[model samples]
Target chain A: MSDFMEQFAELRDQKRFQDIVDAIPYARLMGVELGEDESGELLFSLPFHERNVGNTVLPALHGGLIGGFLENAAMIHLIWNRESLDTPKIVDFSLDYLRSGRPKTLYASCEITKQGKRVAHVLIEAWQEDRSKPVAVARAHFLLATTS
Target chain B: MIATPVNPKVFEPMGQLFVSLPHCATLGFQYLGADGRKPVLKVDWREDLVGNPATGVVHGGIITSLVDTTSAVAVTAHLERFETIATLDLRIDYLKAATPGKAIYCRAECYRLASQVAFTRAVCYHDNPDDPIAHGVATFMRESSPLPMLQEPKA
Candidate 1:
C-alpha cells in the first residue's frame, strides 16, 4: 500500500476526522470548527471575527466567507463519511443568499443528495440564531475518486 | 433602502472603502484602478490562503471572494455611486485550479442595473484573460441610498 493509503486507513479511525478538517489552511484561517449535534450529525461552525467581515457598513460577514465555510463543510463531511484517500474536487458551486450573514457564530450542515462511484452531489444550508431561517443555501457537485 | 441620486465623485473614495474592509485586507486584495471600462482587483499568492497544503494551490473560496467582490465593485461603478448592496445569488464555474505562486486578477462588468437589482458577470485569471481560471455570474440587491459612512480616518 502507498503512504497516502496507509494514512487514509488511519484517518478512518473517526477520532482523527476533526484533525483532518483542521488541517485545511483556509478553514483554520477562518476559525472553522467541527463538532457533533444532538443527533450525532457532523456540524461546522465559524466564530465571528473582524477578519471575516466583508461589509463594514452593514457589518455583515462576507458572502464569500459564508460560501467558503459551507463548501469546506461539505468536503470535510464527504471525507469523514467515505473511505477515500483521494481528496474530492469541486466541479461547481452555486449559492443563494436568502439573507445577510450577520456577524456572529454561524453553523452549517450538509446532506449528500446523491453519491455515485465517481461523483457526488451535496446540499448545504447555513443558519444563524434559528435553523428554520437559513441565511444561505448552496449546491455543490464534486468529483470523487478513491484509491482502494 | 431609500433611493437617491449620488455624486459621481463617490467612485474615487470607493477604493479606500474596499481596502478598509477587514476581509479584503485579510485576503490582501488590491483595488487596481479601473481598466478603461471595468474595475480590476488583484490578490497575490499567499500560503495561508492555500487549500491543498501539499500542492500549495490557493483555495477556490479565495477566487470566489475575488469574483464576488469584483462584481460588487462593478455594480457600484455602473451606478457611479456608493450605495448599499447585498449579494442575492452567485454562480461560479471553475475552469481550472490557480497556478501556485501567481497573483490572480479579476475584472467584472455590470450588465444590467434595474431599479432595485444589479446583474454582473466576472472573469478571474492569472496571466491571460483568454485563459480564465473561473467565471462567475452574480446578482445584487441595490439599496436606494448610500449609507451615512465617512472616509477612513487618516493613519
Candidate 2:
C-alpha cells in the first residue's frame, strides 16, 4: 500500500474521525468540523469566518468555498467506513446555487447515489440555517483506483 | 451582490475589485488584466491549499473558485451594465492535478448574454492555454435592479 494509505489506516484505527481530520492540514485550513446524526452518519460543518465573504453587497459566502465544502464532505463520507487505501479521485463536480448563502456557518451532508466497483457518484446538499432551504446542491463523480 | 458597473470599460477596475474581495484575496487571486477580449486571473500555489498531501497537488476546489470567479469577471467585461449577477450553476471537470508550486492562471469568455441569463466558459492552466488543469462552464442569472431609465419602456 502507498505511504499515505498506510498513514491513514494507522490514524483511522486509533482515533475518532475528527482526529484524523485534524491531522490533515487542508481540512484544518478550511476550519471544517465533523459531527454525526442520530444514526451516526457523518456531517460536515464550515464555521463562519470573515475571510469567507465573497460579495460585500449582501455579504454572501464564496461559491467556491461552498463547493469545496461539498467536495470534501463527499470525500470524507467515502473514506469514513472503508479500509481500502485507494483514495477516491474526483472526476467532475456540478453544483447549483439555489440561493445566496448568508454570512453564516454552512453545513453539508453527502449521500452516495451509486457506488460501483470503480466509480462512485455522490450527491451533496449544503445549507446555512434551514436544511430544507439548501443554499447549494451538488453531485460529484469519483474514480476509485488503487495506488501502488 | 455588487454595485453595477456602468460600462464594459470599467472591466479593469471591476476585475481588480472582484479579486480584492475578501474571499478572492484570501485565496491569492491576481487580476492579470485582459488577454485580448477575455479576462485573465491568477492564483499562486500555497501550502495550505494543497488537497492531496501525498502528491502535493493543489485542491480542485481552488480551480473551481478560479473558474467561477473568472467567469463572473467575463460577464462584467461583456455586459454594457452589470449588477448583482448570481451564479445559477457551475460545472467543473478536473482534467489534471496542479503541480504544487506552480501559479495557475485562467482565461474566460462570456459567450452569450440573453435577457435573463449570461453564459460563460473558462479554462485554468499553469503555462499554456491549450494545456488546462481544469475546464468549467457556468451560467449567471441577471438579476438586474435597473434604474427607471434603464428599464424597458411600455411595449
B1-155 per-residue lDDT for model 2 (tens digits)? 43333364546667887898787888899999876558899999988887777787887878888998999888877666446677899999999778889999999988887888999999999999999989999999886323211222245
TM-score of chain A, predicted model 2, versus the true chain A, to 2 decimals? 0.89
Interface RMSD, model 2, angstroms:
3.5
Residue B21 local lDDT, model 2: 78
Tell me the tens digit of each residue's lDDT in model 1 across A1-148.
2453345457657566557665678878888888888998888889899999988776789988888888888877776677767778788899999988888899999999999999999999999999999999999888887445
Residue pairs whose backbone atoms clash in candidate 1: B3-B144
Q: Compose the digit string of candidate 2's lDDT tens values, residues A60-109.
A: 78888788878888887877666678888899999999988787889998
What 10-residue stretch in candidate 2 chain A is worst by lDDT? A15-24
Query: Candidate 1 on B104-129: residue-level lDDT in tens?
Result: 99988888889999999999999888
lDDT of each: 0.81, 0.81
Question: For candidate 1, what is the recovered fraction of reference interface contacts?
Answer: 0.64
Stretches of candidate 2 exceeding 4 Å from the true structure = A146-148, B1-6, B144-155
Docking verdict class for candidate 1: medium
